[model samples]
Target: MEARLIPIALTIAGSDSGGGAGIQADLKAFSALGVYGASVITALTAQNTRAVTMVEPASCAMIAAQMQAVFDDLEIRAVKLGMLGDAQAIATVAAGLRGRDVPVVLDPVMVAKSGDRLLPTDALTALRTELLPLATVLTPNLPEAADLLDTAPACDEDRILEQGQALCELGAQAVLMKGGHGRGPECVDLLIRANGVTRLSAPRRATQNTHGTGCTLSAAIAAGLAQGMDLTQAVTRAHAYLQGAIAHADGLGVGSGHGPVHHFHGIWPNG
Candidate 1:
């Protein structure tokens, strides 16, 4: 009997030296979900739970070359995009993924864990114009959605649905506006499509290990899609997986702000 090979998912994002977000978190999520993870680092950040002190972006050509090398050898079933730090990097990644008809989960990571800006103000237009249209699903938090739409909607369920719809008009096939930042007992994630809005509500875990929550969620969804799950099912499973990770966060003392969730909670005891 021959052993089946796990499908691969490519994460084109930045490197978080803290291991809390970006490529590190993405790869961890993919591994936890039983997928082989590959990455093309777009930028490197000197960051931790405290704040991002510095960021060094890779050249656009180098970034594109990395993507080419991976796609040439690996059968990447899905792609999760995180922080493309600049307009050039965004355009480069967008061009590279243009012809690849794989499920692409776009986590518009505009802000860092410490509330510092990751995606530059100038890059927002490039991301919206060049990348969002190519995404299979666009996952943005409330602030990100508001930035994309140029208006702040109330954190209510109805407003979230409306915001999701508005985001869809920006060229995404589907929009998942995360409500974790919203003030509520339930972490409501609104999914808007041509069919209508579907609200996925999970009980909010009272934990500070949320640094990589967005990155992990997007990666998990990409893994699910790589394994052939539909959009709704993928999002559902991703949410559950993230909830578990949040509940079992590693008590790694570092800074005063939020820390990293334990991505390998179920797979590895001490991870």
Candidate 2:
């Protein structure tokens, strides 16, 4: 009898010592979704639910070496990128990923849920020039979208659509403008592609344990893509998965501040 083959996905991001966000959350989402997860650490962060005390970035040589090692051994089907810390790291990652055939999910992670800065100011230019064009899907919250556009956060639906379109113009094959940061009864996420735009809306769940929402969502999308789902199917499933995770987050009493969402909501019984 032939052995079963598992889909593999790679995450090139920073490490979250808190075990809630960054590489930790990405791997959890991948595992929960049945995808084998690989990682290339670009930075190590000392953080928890409360705040990020410190951040130490890995050298560019090490980052490139990790990428080469993983790509050499694993048949990576998709990739999810989180925090790269600076312009040099971004350039290195972009170089490593260039010409690869796998789908790329770019989560422009600039700030932490605890209001800590993750990516520096100067890295924005590098992110735009180097990574955006390589991304199959770019996921950014309202503030992140604004920061990328160098404009104010969109408050109205029209502005949100405008910003989403603008981000699509910026080079990403598609852009997922996350509405989690918006003020609304329903959190509406827009998936803007070349041909059309898809709107995925769901009621905002009342839960403070949503620390790794962005990371988890992007990782789930990568997992879906790794499993061979199209863009709409992947985004829709990822959106639904993240919604359930956020809804069930309170079940796990992880930290005092913003806790992590239940990555294994389907597998684990309710509290």
Best by TM-score: 2
Q: Please count the clashing residue pairs in each candidate, in the order shown.
A: 0, 0
Give, for candidate 1, the lowest lDDT window spanning 10 residues: 248-257
Stretches off by above 4 angstroms in model 2 are: none
- For model 2, what is the alpha-carbon lDDT of residue 165? 90
The TM-scores of all predictions, comma-separated, are: 0.96, 0.99
Best by lDDT: 2
Model 1, range 110-197, lDDT digits (tens) per residue? 9987988998888889988998899889999999998888887547888888888877888999999899889878889988898977
**Candidate 2 weakest lDDT stretch, 10 residues:** 156-165
Model 2: per-residue Cα lDDT over 1-271, one tens digit each: 9989999999999999999999999999999999999999999999999999999999999999999999999999999999999999999999999999989999999999999999999999999999999999999999999999999999977899899899889899999999999987989999998899899999988888999999999999999999999999999999999999998899999999999999999999977
Clash pairs for candidate 2 = none
